[model samples]
Target: METLVKLFKNNIRQYGMIIALVVIMILFEMITGGLLLKPINITNLILQNSYILVLAIGMVLVIITGHIDLSVGSIAAFVGAVAAIMMVDLHWHPVVAVIASLVVGALIGAWQGFWVAYVKIPAFIVTLAGMLLFRGLTMIVLKGQSIAPFPNGFQKISSGFIPDFGSAGTNIVAVLAGILFTVIYIVNELRDRRAQKKYNFEVVSGGLFILKLVVIAAIINAFTFMLAIYAGLPNILILLLVLIIIYSFVMNKTVMGRHIYALGGNEKAADLSGVKTKKVTFWVFVNMGVLAAISGLIFAARLNAATPRAGTNFELDAIAASFIGGASATGGIGTVFGAIIGGLVMGVLNNGMSLIGLGVDWQQGIKGLVLLAAVAFDIYNKKKVTFLK
Candidate 1:
């Protein structure tokens, strides 16, 4: 009983945001008259939120490193414009255009990183200037007009669905993927538990572990089944999954990842310990630029156009997602999965409210409240922990 209690408390502290997400989803699902989880709506939700998820992934890293980038929205807009020009007007190959856009993104990152990391300019000021500069450049690039109707190849990046090879009315690929994911998840959990035990670290009891596995498996299979029924997997979904897996591994298992956390936790102490704070900070922004660019391409492809106002306020969305996902504003705290959950929380709220005929004004107001509550919760938890210690 004591072990179970301890496990529950630990899991709550670590996964409270995820639990809140699930609860909010269920509430919205009920309020939406069963429309929230319909197969088509589920697909729409994933597509609509894919670009934000991309940005959130990168933003979490920035927050984890104890900095902020207010220019991501502008950068995304600029990159999208560049892509549109390269592919539409210049007639560059889709593949080559993508490469060029990514290169542009990296250069943008390096530019801001130079100011932030090397020149010792505050990130807030640098990114603020970048926001204005890039937004202006986007307008100039597009000449205050929208570019449209990208090639089919480019559109497919955001709108394509996976081929279905299953029997009529079923998606065999999705089911298989779900099963594989469940197995991998269980195996990883068990392996982690064994490793922790070997190192004499605390671990949940066997029964609790089994329960956790079962619950997660059910959720995974259910989500996959919903997707299978609608249109199988989306191309953007695949991209999001790959990124989540790769970044999760990087953040949780890599030496660079640990160093980033250390840097965020205490910059001066990290420097004293021989951590290259400047290089890490520089690379972190560079990575953020690349992600913002990828998001730009995805967004432009989804809209089939690049407008001057493309990516307006996207930085706010990404930042909110990070904080809602349990990323500490003080840095050195967050997870890739948490960011995904945070994005989903916001996505579902938007979808559900829209379905129920809520106006955009109300939606924005509600979202603002939710963001405040999440940050307040984080601060409360931190204070409680400190008091207890």
Candidate 2:
């Protein structure tokens, strides 16, 4: 019992946000008369928030490097515009267009990165300039008009679902996938716990550990069951899962990830320690640019059109998601999983408010409060930890 309490106390921020998410879901579920968690609505929530979540993944890393990218929204718009021009006007294949779009995104990132990393300009200024530059370019390329009817292959990237192998009801594949994921999660947790024990690291008691596993396993199965009943799993969801796994591994297990944290925590100190601060910083922006492009493509596919207004305020959402997910304003702290949770928090708020007939004005106000509270909570925890130390 004491060990469990200690563990929870040490991880209050991570655990608290998760608990808060559950509470929010339950509140909306009841208020919306069970509409919030309806399988269809759940799927819609994932689809609608998919792009922002992608941006958040990249944004977290940027924040961890003590930087921000304000141009991501405009870059996304520009990339989408370029993609539309290629596919719709130039008659290029979707695969070719996607590759071309990603390359364009990389070039854009390199441009901004040069200013920020090599020229010593602040990221905020560079990205703000980029935001304006790309937005204007998007308008020019699109000629202030919308392009529609993307190829079926492009559309499927955002709207398609995994094929169901089951009979006329639930999706058997989804259920089996859920079960497989649960088993893997459990195995990983147990393995980690064993490693910790071997290293004499503090761990929760056996009873508490088992309880935690059961709860998580239950949540996973329940979520997958919901998807199994309604339209199966989205292709975007699979993409998101893959991204989460890969990024989590990169951030937690790789040397480059450590250098990024060190850079954010103290740039000069990191440089003295032989970390290639400039190169790391430059690559971080490049990565963000690529993710923003991915987001643009996804958003364009979802709308089935590329428009001048495609990525408005997207940068704000990504930044907010990173902060709300527990990325320190000063950098050096955060997780990919945390960013996803933060994005989901925003997504649920948007979905729940719309369901209850709340106006956009109210939705905005509520989300602002949530963002403020999340940051305040982070600051409070930091202060407490500092005081204790």
Per-prediction backbone clash count: 0, 0
CA lDDT for candidate 2: 0.92
lDDT tens per residue, model 2, 1-389 = 77777877877767777887889899999999999999999999999999999999999999999998999999999999999999988989999999999999999988998899999999999998999999999999888999988999999989999998778899998899899999999999999999999999988888888999999999999999999999899999999999999999999999999999999999999999999999999999999999999999999999999999989999988988888888888888888999998888889989999999999999989989998998898899899989999
Error of 2 at 268 (Å): 0.9
Which lDDT tens digits does candidate 1 get at residues 236-311?
A: 9999999999999998899889889998999999999999999999999999999999999999999999999999
Q: What's model 1's overall lDDT?
A: 0.92
Candidate 2 wrongly placed segments (more than 4 Å): none
- lDDT scores for all predictions? 0.92, 0.92
For model 1, where is the 10-residue window of minimal lDDT? 5-14
